[model samples]
Target: MSDSPSSWPDLATLRDRIDDIDRQLQVLINQRAECAQQVAQSKMAAEGDDTHFYRPEREAQVLRQIMERNQGPLSSEEIARLFREIMSSCLALERPIKVAYLGPEGTFTQQAALKHFGHGAISVPMTAIDEVFREVEAGAVDYGVVPVENSTEGVISHTLDSFMDSSLQICGEVVLRIHQHLMVGENSRPDKISTIYSHASSLAQCRKWLDAHYPHAERVAMPSNAEAARKVKGEWHSAAIAGDMAAELYGLTRLAEKIEDTPDNSTRFLIIGRQEVPPSGDDKTSLMVSMRNQPGALFEVLDPFHRHGVDMTRIESRPSHTGVWNYVFFIDFKGHTASSNVQQVLQDIGEKAADLKILGAYPRGVL
Candidate 1:
């Protein structure tokens, strides 16, 4: 006879099954951690004290593999993030990574650092982009994360300038989707918010939204979004425009969400490290080229890339500090420096340009 609906396993039975699965998950996770520890031992035996535990390219490849193999109710990105945290914990069994980022804390740079290195990393907050570079250069951290460009605001000139002075390599890249929110303190009244505080870029990104919603409100630019959130905490007449990270860090309530005028606004951040990252199957190379001032100098510099069929992803011109009239082009393109075609293109461009610095070849952002 067929069983009645009541005879089927109830919610409690399903929960018990979940408990059993959790137990199995715990066992498998510990086993993975043990394997990571064993891997560390093998590395130490092979390379002694000079062994590098963090392999950025290998990590990127693993994450991409996980995403590709994922098949579940969860999205590929969600699965990859889960694997990210798992890898983070396992890597901690070997050694924790210390990362430096531009911050007062609770900033997007910090978010990118955490996203790339996972929670197992020790993240140090630096006051400025230059400070972040200095910390990594001084061996105070394993790596540094800095904002290179924003979709809406163009390139971060300070970050680009820092690269010109530092020898750090680009180890990896992270693209973070930015969602600016209008937040207020618990004691603040949304109706009485007389002023809005945010960073200049944030203000600009949300200009249209602010104009439509709070037309008469005075907008003030602060040093950073976290600073703006902190300033609004004690003021009943002020609100802050920042991201969810800042809002949660300062215990502010979101009055409106995703207030940025551009719905798909995102920022690209770079991971700077003392050690060079080997090429992953998929990679990108960045270079800063200074061409002799002449007609078609830019074309001469770019022609080699096109001739080689190397896809140029982006190119930005910055004023050269060495000469008033000279300009440097920061170019990013697909393929790794180690690849034959990339090497040929670089050699060709090197012959044409006054100076060419291959920043580093790193795996493109997968998640």
Candidate 2:
């Protein structure tokens, strides 16, 4: 039976229904906020006045549960994001977290930070990745977010190197899908863009696209994409290849959208903090292993993971700071460090490796 306009509720009635739902949502949200407040009180009572209110594992679990149980018109990611904002607001009622990211603002690292911590968090921008680590280590910020690797451009070696010098633990991770855009200022002539600015990795990511479209344009690599966007704002004949955030921040118009060579380009960012994150059921642990410069050293290090049934997600070798010829392997694998098999694997690797540092075991990215 098809319902006609006369049988269906009028626009006014539909609006009234929406208003009623909104009111109910408001009440429920407040109730949730009150419960969060009570949680804060309980934590203070148990762990003194300086208690850490942010629980990465607990938040990850809650978000995962929300996504798993959601049966709605909204997508799982959308619902998870809504809950993320709610949790962020509730956490602010307890304690507002300050997060540092590699940026001069409008950088992807900043986007990743906001994506993970929500808009309620205070996000600070640092010029370099090491500065982000420094701020967190110095207690200037509660946490820091930095890019670890990109799907299109490969690993960020600077981030991995920073880990070697810092004691910050990876508390969480967030993966951002990279979508590069060709943006220009209002006065800029699209046909006369003589130079394009972007980070080296970004330039490389869009190499094929740029080669085909703007073959003669001079590609200048900048420190960050946001910086490139900023640089283009003053020049009429120059354009910038940046992300949506940067384009919006600088009021640049996108002449061309999604111009990356690869459609599935993405970057994985790590959340760094001072404290260890407890196990979330679905978690990944990152470790740095420095093996002796000997035959089968890599085999000995990786053999334990295979034997213990640990699934290795990634393995990247970086030049060891300790020696000229030596290399350190940055390994990421599924399973919490506290798990029996993971523990056994680590123990075995510890025996074989010259040095091993467990960066952290954090919940995998949820959105």
Candidate 3:
């Protein structure tokens, strides 16, 4: 069972090679840190502001460039993550941005939050979506991230509803591609897998695949995918449906990959903060309106956008809860609230609708 002498690596040579690689990495990391300091100095001088720091746009540009020019055995994603951690370390020389997201950890929302803030900022994972907003509203966290919508499914109604009552502003956004995986405990065999657990949405998304493969396995809905993974033990006849990252985070083995019903499933997340986002050039504004419960009343509400030639991206209605058949319409359009077209539309809609409220305008999440 022992390796042949010829098959073994030369220990002394390997050690020397490893030392050389380490030295190279150390030099590169230091150089990157120095550049970040220079960037900080320049930003300070240009803005003539001491308190202003952490450029989201510039960080985004750096990651975009890395993704564009990457020619790698490692993917654009892997390369970008490397730079993200590097920038995170560099940013730590200054103050850390505290961000909150819906979580108990190992959730997709947590991934979006981390992707947006990088590892530089302090990430606080909350149990509920409303908690994310509260942290940012209370100034306990500098910003918050929450899922706003999905590609296949519709908007996250709870998030949209929460915005109707909250005072926080949408400062930015990021879209993360959702890849679901089936994971089980290390000691569980594939044949022994029985019950599967996950969040309801996760279970629904993978229903067809699960029906085809594990038809007899009982499906259990849990609060979060991470919690579902946590519940699976080696002795139990159970496995959990989650993401690959969750599997790695919780020491679970992947039973399958990309097991969702659709290949392009993605979720859009919003960044909420106290300050308004100065136009990022490309942006979307969300609004809520309550129209009179009458015929063509909805058309009267939407007629302003058509007249102004503004692009309306999304429109959804929720029961106004004001007794018999009252409803509220949530709208997403292709311009920021600061733009003239958007401003005029708001002006017109204010005159037309029973009630209207501008949620927030922020950069559209490109990724």
Best by lDDT: 2
Displacement of residue 234 (Cα, Å) in model 3 is 4.9
RMSD of each: 1.8, 1.0, 5.9
Residue 365 Cα positional deviation in candidate 2, in Å, after optimal superposition: 0.8
Error of 1 at 199 (Å): 0.9
What does candidate 2's lDDT look like per residue over 102-126, in tens digits? 9988999999999999998999999
Task: Point out the worst 10-residue segment of candidate 3 by lDDT.
Answer: 49-58
**Tens-digit lDDT track of model 1 for 1-367:** 3598867889998999999999999999999999999999999999997888999999999999998898888999999998899999999899999999988788988998889989999899988999999999998988999999999999999999998888999999999999999999977898888899999999999999999999999999998898899999888889999988899899999999999999999999999998888889999999999999999999998899889999999999999989989999999999998899999999999999999998989999987
Give the distance in Å from residue 140's predicted Cα in candidate 2 to where it truly belongs: 0.6
TM-score of each: 0.97, 0.98, 0.82
lDDT of 1 at 348: 93
Question: Which is better, 1 or 2, measured by lDDT?
Answer: 2
Best by TM-score: 2
Those runs of model 2 whose alpha carbons end farther than 4 Å from true positions after fitting are 2-6
2 or 3: which has the higher TM-score? 2
lDDT (tens digit, per residue) of candidate 3 on 238-275: 88998866787889988799998989999889888877
Q: How many backbone clashes does candidate 2 have?
A: 0
